[model samples]
Each structure stands twice: as C-alpha cells, then as structure tokens.
Target: MRKSAALALAACVAVPAFARTDVGVSIGINEPGAYGRIDIGNFQPEVVYAQPVIIERSRYYENRTPVYLYVPVEQQQHWRRYCHVYRACGEPVYFVQEQWVEQRWREEHPGWRRHHRGWDRWDHDRGEHRGYGY
Candidate 1:
C-alpha cells in the first residue's frame, strides 16, 4: 500500500512536468502589448508625456534624436527600473499613447487574424481551429 501511494504521488507530479506547454508570442510594433521603439512614419503619434523620459543620461546619445516607443503604462511610470528591457537606458524615450498604438495597428492590419502555425498546429490537428479566412 505504501509503495502504491508513493507511486501515485510521483505520477501526479511527473504528469504535470511532462504536460507543461510553453507558448511564445512575439508582439511586433503597433501590436497590442508591444513594448519597444515604434516607427513614427508620417503619422503624428499622441504621446503619453510631453517631455521625453531619459533614465540614463549619456554623452553618446546627446546628438541622437529621441525615439518614440510604445511601452506599458507601468513601465513608462517606472522607466528607471524597466528601461533596460527595451535597451534604451542611455537614450531618450517618448512613450506613445496606448489608444493611438491600437488604432494604428487596427488600421494597418484591418483583416489580421491570429495564425496558429508550427507548434501551434496542434490546434488545427485537434479541429479546434476556426478557419482564419485562410
């Protein structure tokens, strides 16, 4: 009975370890939840703050122009702590308004649909995929 209980507990733990699935989604510029430098292009972006936020001041970036970014609200507020994530610690950053980013993404990818390819093809095999209009 003790061996069976121990085996059952081991099986329970091992099952979850093997069943773990990691899904990596790369969010590009203008996409929802994307945090990085954004291409300003010809469109004027509404900024979150009027003044650019500079976490780390460096002489190297003095001549370089301030780049616009679309970062999370929390990251924008605590830029000093999160600037390294975007590799803009030594440069000036202007956080664009989230609403504007979403609007631009929708405009550009009017018919965008999430594509389940590669490892995500399991959904297609399981018949869980709703046709994405090809």
Candidate 2:
C-alpha cells in the first residue's frame, strides 16, 4: 500500500498539465470547504467511493428492477479474492471505486466485446471504434 500510494502520488505529480486547446467545457470542483479544480469536457464525470458490497453468490439484481449487473466469476482478480478473504476475517477494506469497470474495459479494448465472437467486430477500419462514434 505504501509503495502503491507513493507511486500514484509520483505519477500524478509527474503528469503534464497541457493547457486545454480544444473548445471544451470546464467544471469547477465541489467540496464542503475545499474547491475542486475545473474539469474540461462535454459532460461532467466523477466517481465516488461507495461501500464494498458482499454477496453470498455475488449475483444480486437491482432492488428496483431489470437493470441486472454482476461481478463476473472471471474477474475475481488475485487481489480481489485476497481482499474478500481479508474482509471475511473482519478486516476493513478500503478499495478503489469499482463503478463503470465494465465501461472502462470496453473503452480500453473496444475491439472485443464481452463473450461475443464472429457476428460482430469492433471495426477500427476508421482508426477508431464506430461504437465510440469517432
């Protein structure tokens, strides 16, 4: 954790803050006492650290309706399993926010969709995924 925190801090501090050159929107950071810096983009995007959810089967439907989501059995990364066991043993786990994990993976590897083959392809023939509307 110490190493990871240090590395993350170093990476953030090392980032090149290129002045925004494109015509973009900017959003100010919001906090109780501290102000957040401007975020430039078409839409405002942010993430909050929600509590870790545990599941006996890890298969829970939304309390409201058909918006079904799951933690794929294949996604139990080594660290995740370790954390699950650690928490089971009553240790507090402060994990990174896991929302939009599916979206993030899709964004990074748009060429491949989850569990699909042949009938569809992420056509990068235009040098970008048409799904991304480039």
Candidate 3:
C-alpha cells in the first residue's frame, strides 16, 4: 500500500510538469517593483531597450494578455507622435517586441519564414484599410 501511495504521489508531481501550457509571454528581468507600462499598438513594436523591459500577463477570456512597460521618455514621445498621426490610440494594445511575435508565429506556422518585415500581416493589412472608414 505504501508503494502504491508513493507511485501516485510521483505521478501527481510529474504530470503537471508536462501538462503546463506555454502562453507566449516571458520576462527578461525579475526586479522587484517592476510594473507594466501602458502600450499603444496593435501588437508588440520593435524598439531599442535602453533599460530592462518588463511585461505582465493575465488570463483574459480564452487567451493570455500581455502588458508592456513604458519606453524611455524620448522613445515614448516618438511613438506617441506616430500613434496620433496613424490614429492608433484608444485601441486595445499589448506591449510585445517584434522578435517575440516572430518566434511565436514561426512556432504556430511551421515552414513559413519571417518575411513580414517589422509589423505582422495583421498590422500591414490594417494600415492598408486605415485609409477607408475603419
């Protein structure tokens, strides 16, 4: 009976390790008091990180949502200008880097290379449709 109990305990521990899901979000730093900054983009945008960028994730509906930390003041101003020009504010935005998107895309769509340039196909198509009433 002791052997059976031990076996069951071992299985309980081992199963969860393999049953975990990958939500496609990761943190590069583990600093205390790190907080997610407000993001204003369709997807994660490419930027030069002068400081360590922190992202937070929460389970939303059936998918996980990521929030990106704010960039430096200068970078924020530049991005704000672009947002105003493109009318991309007041939309649901998640902070993600370009590389992270590419990696996730490659995993989902195997055999397809990352050829969409900086923005993904959705952003590209959105830009095209923005000229119309969208």
Which prediction has the highest lDDT against the true structure? 1
What TM-score would every model get versus the actual structure? 0.57, 0.24, 0.28
Ranked by TM-score, the better of candidates 2 and 3 is 3
lDDT by residue for model 1 over 67-129, one digit each (tens)?
788888888888999988888888888888888878778777887654624486546567655
lDDT of 3 at 22: 46
Better of 1 and 2 by TM-score: 1
Segments in model 3 whose C-alpha atoms lie over 4 Å from true places: 23-47, 53-75, 78-134
Model 3, 17-62: lDDT tens per residue?
8864644444342221232343334444454454322222224423
lDDT of 1: 0.76
Best TM-score goes to which candidate? Answer: 1
Q: Give the TM-score of candidate 3.
A: 0.28
Candidate 1 TM-score to native: 0.57
What lDDT tens digits, residue by residue, belong to model 2 across residues 77-108?
A: 34345435333313222232234344544565
